[model samples]
Target: MKKVLILSTALTSVAMAASAEEISVMSWGGAYATSQIEAYHKPFTAQTGVSVINVDADNPAAPIKAQVEAGNVTIDVVDLEYADAVRMCDEGLLEPIDPAILPAGADGTPAADDFLPGAVAECFVATIVFSTLYAFDESKFPENPPTTIADFFDTAKYPGKRGMRKGAKVNLEMALMADGVPAGEVYALLETPEGVDRAFAKLDTIKNDMIWWEAGAQPPQLLADGEVVMTTGYNGRFFAAAVAEGKPFKQVFDGQVYEYDGYAIPKGAPNMERAKEFIVFASQTQQLADQAKWIAYGPARKSSGPLVGLYQDGKTEMGPFMPTAAANLTNALPSSYEFWVDRDAELNERFNAWLAQ
Candidate 1:
């Protein structure tokens, strides 16, 4: 009896140790990360008995690439934009996620059939559809309020510094649209050298008045502190500040560029199985719907749409604020993943040289 008791105690300890395993996740931090924490991370941990260590990256793609190429992969999973996800997959920096393992939708539709068009990719499973939109402090723009993308570059009219991401992707697209290129023609024109120059020339107009931001959290802070009269940032970040924190920020949906942000495992993540498990758990229909309650981003799953309604506050409707809403899409542009996947390196190089000059 004494010998049996000792063996039982040892087995239980081993099981407890195995159950306490941890996985590191990297993402764009701020209310976005908070929404994932409340909707996906906490519930996943509670259900699986696995510990999640969350980390922030200005852009998870950059650090994830570095970590993978260095052969020192610490992050098990990362949330990345559609283009970055596709680019990374092409570079073989990420592990391929199998659609077979993903759960079916709440209404019994297959995973492949249920996700929004282009949401699921070879290397990543998309979680949310978000937009890069500019926001302003209402107090700063009361008289002649800035409304359009052209106004974002009109420093003489708005008369204050503007906050833009420290990257060439969305800015270039917005520049073209602001400079009178139709949203439909923006990418087609950008395929040429002269068109690239035109976009940069538009950007040059506001270069002196620009304050560059990397993290999603910085724009709201910059707006609230009166450091910038207008700033381009994720729509959800502005929503959190305006609705949750009761800040006076207002999003400029005109010329907003919408895209998907999703999950991908590093090529040689330490906790591959557990990371895959987390993805499966978080990508379920109900889980995706739950995320919208915390942030205004539209869930990637179509089945999750009807289920989405109120914000976590329980009174504010989240539909009209979503980037995919018909009202918001009238003047909006859909970000082209293929364009960025092929041109990201070259354009960013030119962008860097332009910055230096």
Candidate 2:
């Protein structure tokens, strides 16, 4: 149960007064975002007298569209991918935020600079940074396991079936990286004809072992069920899985792609004032640090707390299975979101054609 006194919990009366009227927060279900809501959002409501209406959706887009189309600005706040937020805002589906109303202390409001530089945007601030890594069950590979995407393809060496996300960005980047292009060069490679072709050619090698994961939840489920020894998805899902089930699976962040999830207010939100309050309440730096413990997603505010890296109590979570460790985070390659955002539709067309071929 949350402490009933909002003013006492956050050291502010602003949030306390706002909580009386409920604001709805839309997010993916399961332990993924619930932990943050419970630890952060719930407390925010309790102290401020605000009632937060939580909305859960497997695919959040349809409902957001429906809500907006229905002329119901019921979804006062949206926690969604940056791309969707940008698109929605471009479509006049989002509202600009006034940061002044966001909770602030003597030091001023926790600004975008407080977050990962990648997560800040015109109308949306990235709430977290999530990465996808190659994970393997340690016991399945007593000695040699896939360390990099190249190894993931080295069926001769790490010969179990491999898993990759059905999604395009990370998969494309990994294919290019595995084809011997340097990590830094992966994006530029796709910019050229040869690089794009090279990625598909490389992908052909393990296409048979590949299982296309639709939801972000599937890859981790694959690992848990022993369907495939290695797979990729949000590093948090796999990490949280291991933490939740005490599974033997591991994640390797080496050359993983990370993306910034943003906190956006829909355009013409009915409760615009309250939405701003929610964003401020959601991003308290201390709460971010606490959230990292429950969700593998790291704080956009890097200053939060000691995030689990490759080690827990001095043990390394590295190798092929774990991506959240510091060592893996250090070496991991990330996707070019700007490139993907710009060319994804074209790339998707070409990729689909290639898949058919």
Q: On residues 56-143, what C-alpha lDDT tens digit does candidate 2 reach at each position?
A: 8765655787778778767888877766666666667777665444433224436644565656666776667777667888778888
> On residues 215-248, what C-alpha lDDT tens digit does candidate 1 reach at each position?
8899999999899988999999999999999999
Number of colliding residue pairs in model 2: 27
> Candidate 1 has which clashing residue pairs, if any?
none
State each model's CA lDDT, in order.
0.92, 0.70
Cα-based TM-score, every candidate: 0.94, 0.82
